[model samples]
Target chain A: MAGLLLSPTEKVFILHGVQDDYRSDGRSNIDYRPMELETDVVSHASGSARLRLANTDILVGVKTEIDVPKPDKPDCGKLEFFVDCSANATPEFEGRGGEQLANSISNMMQKAYHSSQAFNLKQLCIFEGKQCWKLYIDILILECGGNLCDAVSLAVKAALFNTRIPFVKAALMDGGNIDLQLSDDPYDSKLLDVGSAPLLVTLCKIGDKCVVDPSAEEENCSVISLIVGLTGDRKYYYPKDADKQQSVESKCTTIGMNGPGSVAPKTLKDAINQGIVAAKSLDEALGQALLKERQQNIGIKKHSYGFLK
Target chain B: MPGPDLLSSQGLRLDGRRPNELRRIRCKLGVFTQPDGSAYLEQGNTKVLAAVYGPHQASKSKSTTEGVVVNCQYSMATFSTGERKNRPRGDRKSQEMSLHLRQALTAAIKTELYPRSQIDIYVEVLQADGGAYCAGVNAASLALIDAGIPLRAYACACSASMAWRNGEPEPLLDVGHVEEAAGGVVLTVASLPNTGSIALLEMSHRLHMDYFKVVLSRAMQGCRDIEIILDKAVRDHLAEGWTKQDVVTI
Candidate 1:
């Protein structure tokens, strides 16, 4: 969404609309535009998901590897985030042109997934201090409409939810060596527990008001935006345990801001609260969609509609 | 001759395809609005996206008085292959692929028509199951057409491999990742099928001079077949009302 061209009159109109709590497209301040999500799209990766929010297209693939646990964090595995902005999105991103933007997004995502409350790294542990699973989450930006961080986070969460770790038996051999064996059965794997995976929500400040999921026009009008990453309730991901579900408050894992505009403390607090509400609703909807797809998969072969559809 | 068990006893190559058959090709043009032209193409398991920009004024250093400068880049997503890739581009293999793309596309483009100008073609591979270069070339060709750039002919690329059935040698068309890794001679060709001229030709591994003609011919035949599929796609795209803007060509 490189500098969209809009006359002064258009910007003012968008500003007035934001002040009135009604966007030009008739969306309220906290409403997000419709988005489509699909999982297990890439056959090569261990897990994959594609998210389309308006014109923004994000594809995330999760690949797993076996590695020795860190000397300090012997009980935890590793997680790495890499973001690639493809030239297909915009020619301006060609050949290292988009590196700066890519680095920022990946760094922010890394920070978001750092908190233990957001993602549990201990589940990836194989043999305590000996070995663990390292997950590589690669995000590819095919098209950019606006609000890239939100789309990428959602896509990555879905990809993680779709990821599977094969069952491995580790045996401690004589002296200090470890021998690992993987079962031959394809079903000998377990799905990753991603109930508390964080989702990012961007709040664009326009005309003294904050709005969620701003369009490119609104993005161009706003000088500042705040991105909040918050955790979702575990009950939604595991509906079978609804009777025993516990009520947990959503927690913020990371908060970031962009643009040169200054924010008042009061407005910043209010915007962060607004972002949390928006993220919870998004999480609920995503959980429902993913669960429904899982239900459908059990009855028959899941027909993958990749880019063709 | 085909090495290893690349060919089953029934004479069918790996992945259940005859030696002369190609993988299924599916393509769509104008997938993105930001670029001057864009296309998404999937040849069997391989998927690629291509975008085209310019015929705008060339950068000062790249401009030439005789013809337009053609620039190409080839990149793959880090998660596109079986093993995760650490970087997307700026590698030796990707650089060579970019050079090969520029060579094939430059031949079909009417570069002399736009003097002192430039055209940029960028290809991104979303999934790679072998023949990534050929898929990139095909996708870029469509992107060029979507941009409505004038061309001598559609520059199509395809790969062929040498396999043995019974006592005779067979040329496998549109080799997949399995057959490619089976250690056989793979001959890749990019050609202007309409003009019956080869734009670029590359081969890896060993092959007898006597069988070289057959392998080259098989790859060329594949290009011709791909040209037909691409032509039909362009026609369908036009019929679906992409002609709102006049495709004015010089």
Candidate 2:
């Protein structure tokens, strides 16, 4: 992390603002900065998305491969997360400098998606106890502006939503071998059911108060941050259709704490509650945006606005 | 032995491109604000983003009095290629690319003017459909220009491969991934088009001595065409921001 040099007075000012539930940028404690999101940005990827939350730019691409399922979990698919902290984000990340941070973020995502209720791996299964789809979720951190965990999770979920898996038929061959045939048509594919995918929310503990989506300056003011990953509701994902709505309770899939500071038991509990609320709202907004984009893409050629826009 | 059919019977390449035609290039400068300069470039399906930082004081171990040190790093996203990559950087291939990038960009930058300083250029490939090194060079050049670094000239790079069209030697410009993987000789050239000077030239695989010149010339021609497009983009970017400065001057 690049440290921001702040005088004691500026730190006190930020502390006082956080105590008042008002931030320097006129945002509430639970308010997140405006973000720009675009999907299907990378043509070579099965699914891809780019999200710019303030200045923290994250690009995620999902690539699908066919492989044998694990012996213990023969009926489920695999999801692997790889995070690359690009040197372009900062000179400090050059060479192997950003490996520690990248590994931490990837581990966080891996844990968040580990729960079956959060993401059903059965959807990726091609053949029982045999061939299955292995998705590689590659995350590229182009720029850093704080609140990276939240942004990365959001981008990953969006990328998964945009992913299209081709239909494959498996035939039982002699000696327990399976022959697979893939569809030739590009559009003849099924979209992943990402309605229950988890999203992360980071609550930075500033002066005994926590804030969501802290800016870079605010992040410097805080000594610790609690990250909570909560599963999303499908009802919010398809609001226009009542039949598709399911009243699934949002569950906590994973929780992580960063920085060296420690909090009291009561404060930690409150922060986790705050993070859950924030994640739910964030998930709703993301689901609505993705649904709208998909609606617009129907029967029309999608004009990809990648890095150009 | 003749290579795979890179050129169809109708004289079109596998991607429906003419032998001398370069892929469509869309580029934008100043794509990021944190770095001193940044640019994004898309050459066909290959996409690269480059960022440049500093002409600041160099670290003690790498300092030099004669000229500024140009440090380059080339990394590709794990999902950029058809096969998933375990590590994004520090690989032998990426390290070699970093050195080649430095070699090409050092030739264009006026390094002597900023003695004992270091300029860092980092390029990240988001999607690699082939000619990633060429796209990296082009993106880095635009990023250097955006950083207002003094340059001798715009350094552009393009790759060319020799193919046969009706038993006649035909040189292909801007080889794509499929073409490069076809086991043909790919000649990559980086040059300053305005100065008519070559910065870096590399060839993969072997070609006949008689046809090397033709392939190299075709790559050079592609560089010239790319230079024109880059120059126009720079001018357009300048025009967009000059309005505010013009009012202040008045």
**Highest lDDT, which number?**
2
Which runs in model 2 stand beyond 4 Å of their true positions? A244-246, B1-4, B242-250
Residues B11-119, model 1: lDDT tens digits: 8777998889999999988877667888889999999989898888998999999998999999999999988899999999999999999999999999999999999
Best by DockQ: 2
Query: Can you write out model 2's per-residue Cα lDDT over A50-139, one digit (the tens) per residue?
Result: 999988899999999999999999999999999999999999999989999999999999999999999999999998798999999999
Q: Candidate 1, A159: how far from true, in Å? A: 0.5
Q: Lowest-lDDT window of 10 residues in candidate 2 chain A?
A: A237-246
TM-score of each: 0.96, 0.96
Q: What DockQ does predicted model 1 obtain?
A: 0.52
Candidate 1: what's its TM-score on chain B? 0.96
The lowest-lDDT stretch of 10 consecutive residues in candidate 1 chain A is: A169-178
* Model 2 lDDT tens row, B1-250: 3553888899999999999999999999888877888899999999999999988899999999999999999999988998888889899999999999999999999999999999999999999999999999999999999898999999999999999988889999999999988889999999999999999999989999999889989999999999999999899988778321123100
Give one digit per residue, the lDDT tens place, for model 1 in A1-309.
574688899999999998998889888999999999999988888899999987789999999999999999999999999999988787788899999999999999999999999999999999889889999999999888899999999999999999988898546576776888876565679999999999999999998899999888889999999999999888889988877978678999999999999899999999999998999999999999999888889857679777666
Docking class of 2: medium
**What local lDDT score does residue B169 receive in model 1, on the 0 to 100 scale?**
83
Show pairs that collide, candidate 2.
none
